[model samples]
Target: MNTLTINQKNKKNAARIAAFALLIMTIFAGLAFGMIHSNLIVMSDPALTLENLMSQSSKFTIEILAWIVIALMDFVVAVAFFYFFKTTNPQLAKLSAALRILYTLFLSVGIYHLIQIAINLDHTVLSTDIMIHLRSFDVLWSRGLIIFGLHLIVTSLLMFQTYKIPKILSALMLIAGLCYFTVHALYWIAPSIETTTQSIENLLALPMTIGELSFGIWLLVRGSRKPFLNATERFGFNA
Candidate 1:
């Protein structure tokens, strides 16, 4: 095979890996959230404490594993895109790649706090636990979500400019990214918004998740040409 063909194959393989990772992580996150939702409905008092909510994750070990896996998957994707962008379009790569890296770092910290929230929920309710450490968990949760929201927006913008993928896909991603921004703003400002907002945001995740999965699958199952191969040919990889 020629060098170009080899590169194409490598990119396809990378896409497959990213798609599988996204699919699995989406499943795990869905299951975990579903359990949390069920618990939320059954519990009395309505204001779920950090500790109480976390307690519902009966399979803490598995949940933790899933979280770690998903975050790592995101990190891998970010790296892959960085390389791809470096080859394809440096300016776009710099923005999305940076956001992905930031998202991964914040997610790592956020997941840690989530686990802490779970353990505490086992012991106490919101009145007691939510206020623990001056609402540190709440702050972390908000910041993490904000960072992630930015990641989605940045990725969506980058994808919009990409050639191989359909523009509609990126458009939806942009919408989802907007949703994240709205929800995060609400979280930061109102801080006591109804659970409905959370539900709404979670719903957006479904599409966003699909977008990522679809992109990955497209790259793997149906090979895509390098978006700007003509341009690359003229400018070379350095471009």
Candidate 2:
């Protein structure tokens, strides 16, 4: 095959890898951060939060594994996209992938604190330290997500410029990026209005999910250019 054909094949393979990884990452993230974290940690009541974690230790262990899977998948998707788009815009692709790697590194560091909590769970006297670590995880993860927002913006720009994907996908991603950037900025900068920012995030969460989720589904459903073939003729075994 020619170099161009080889590159096209590589991109297709990378797209499939990225698509599958993205879906897995999203599912684990929803379980880890959305369900488990929300159920365990209550910022308003740290002692109660610790009690919840102690009581639901099994679930918390699953949450930690889920987060590890998410970070791993993030790396997988990052590497895959770097190859997939290197031909189109090498510099942007590298930068985007780098940002995601940075985010994943930050997230991994945050998850380490949870591991620590698991290690020291039996030490009830260390409630203060345990809760502090939990808070650190949230803060550190949120900081990482700010960089993730930038990654999304750059990825969306690439999508917008590329004719192969739909423009609406890019638009949705842009919106998601803006929402993440703005809400988190509000959380750190204007702590007094956290409730307001959370409300905004809840309202805009659909776009955030729809952008990447739809893109993943689109990647799975897309077929390469091929001649039409009847089902029976293609397989040739069944009646």
Candidate 3:
């Protein structure tokens, strides 16, 4: 094969690897956020929350394990996206990777609260303190989402400028990022508007879910099908 053919093959392989990473990220995140954590932890009721954690300590531990898996997969996804899109704009790709890593760091720290809850579950004397810590998880996660939203916005902009991904996917990502930022910002800025913010969040869930899931599936299915010879051409730059 000629040099051009060799390079094309390498690009295709890279795209495939990145796509697989995204798929793994999606699966792990779904299990962590949707299945394990959401089911096991009751955010509103302190007594019920403690009882569940204490009664289902093993399951709680499994949830934490799932979260750790999610964190590891998130790092993989960040690196994969950086590698895949670095040709379009290296600086923006680096920024995107950095923001994602920062969000992961925040989530890693936040997991400590969950771990503490598991450890203190058997100690009835620590019940009150544990409840306070449980509430902290919600706050910490919201703050982490703020950073995650910024990462998504940057990633979406990069996608928009590149020919590898669809423009509609980029638009979806932008909408999801805006939803995350707006909802969380409202939650923090005006505690009195909790009901209003929650209603907005429920509406925002549709775009966020569709955007992220569709993007992941696209990456898994079609990411390696075509390679752009001139990545910056779509953005009006010389190859």
Ranking 1 against 2 by lDDT, winner? 2
Lowest lDDT block of 10, candidate 2: 223-232
Candidate 1 runs further than 4 Å off: 1-10, 36-58, 117-127, 130-139, 192-196, 199-209, 223-238
TM-score of each: 0.72, 0.90, 0.88
Off by over 4 Å in 3: 1-14, 231-239
User: What overall lDDT goes with each candidate model?
Assistant: 0.61, 0.80, 0.77
lDDT of 2 by residue, 146-215 (tens): 8888888888886775446777887888888777777777777898998998898899889877877787
TM-score, cand. 2: 0.90
Alpha carbon lDDT at 152, candidate 3: 87
Q: Residue 60 error for model 3, in Å? A: 0.7
* True lDDT of residue 129, candidate 3: 82
Clashing pairs in 3: none
- Model 1 whole-model lDDT (C-alpha atoms): 0.61
Candidate order (TM-score) = 2, 3, 1
Candidate 1 on 1-239: residue-level lDDT in tens? Answer: 76555555555555566566666766766655454434443233445534444554566545556677878877877777665444455676677767777777776786776566555554445545434522453466556667666766776776665546667777776776677667877877775774876787777767645656566666556533443332453444423
Model 3 worst lDDT window (10 residues): 230-239
